[model samples]
Target: MIGNDVIDLALARKESNWKRKGYLDKIFTADEQAMIVRAENPTLMVWSLWSRKEAVYKIHNRTAHFRGFIPLKIACQADGKVLCGGQFYFTDTIVTAESIATVAVLEERQLSQICYLQDREEVVKKEGFPYRKTNSKPVSISHHGRFEQIVTLTD
Candidate 1:
């Protein structure tokens, strides 16, 4: 399975105060919190990790048949590997001045097959999940503030 998430930095900064007391604790593990603290850009790190978790959560829900956002329950390593129910999902993340985007796959090798598309219209809904219309490849679309990402797999 494939999944993705995106975060717009400007809007995030305007909307959330990540430094607020207990916010990091509520969403991150102790180790994750440490990473954020040590990061040169703590704000970027927080959202990067969050986007990774959100991307992995999409795949987790498909296999586990569960719903809801349980951030701490899903653990993410600094290397973009996410642990959910003992299963490992690998993620590829992009960080820019304005946004952060992440794409996840069940197998690490699948990461190489991921393709980011500029055409949003290629996406269609199947059982409420996104997919590419031409080849029916699973598509993950995420929009936040001014940024959006459309991801799919090839073969």
Candidate 2:
């Protein structure tokens, strides 16, 4: 399975205050918070980390049928890995000044098999989750402010 997320920087800045009291503590583990503190751009780091967890969580949710916002239970390691419910997911993230996009897969090697696309017309929702209409491969779609990203795992 594969999952993806996108975050628009401008919209995030306007919508979220990561520095608000207890916010970081609520969203990040201690190690992740330290990473944020030491980051050159703390805000970007926060969102990058958030996107990674979210991307992986999407895959986890699909497999586990889990529902809820349990951010702390999902951990983001520095090496593009996410740990949740004792399972590991690998992530590839693209960060720009305007947005951050992340794609995650169950196997590390599948990272290269992720296809990013812009054609939304081929996407359809099945049971509230997006999938490719042609092949029915699980498709992930995320949009934030000015950015929208679509991804699917290729055979």
lDDT of 2 by residue, 19-75 (tens): 999999899999999999999999999999999999988998999999899899999
Quote the lDDT for 102 in model 2.
94
Question: What are the lDDT figures for the candidates, one per model?
Answer: 0.90, 0.92
| Model 1 bad stretches (over 4 Å) | none
lDDT, candidate 2, equals: 0.92
Residue 75, model 1: lDDT of 93
Cα lDDT, model 1, residue 153 = 90
What is the Å distance of residue 57 in model 1 from its true position? 0.8
How big is the positional error of residue 117 in model 1, measured in Å on the Cα after superposition?
Answer: 2.2
- At residue 55, what lDDT does model 2 achieve? 93
- lDDT tens string, model 1, 1-155? 89899999999999999889999989999989999989998889999999999999988887688998799998999888999878989999999999999999999999899988897788889888878989998888889998888888998
TM-score of each: 0.95, 0.96
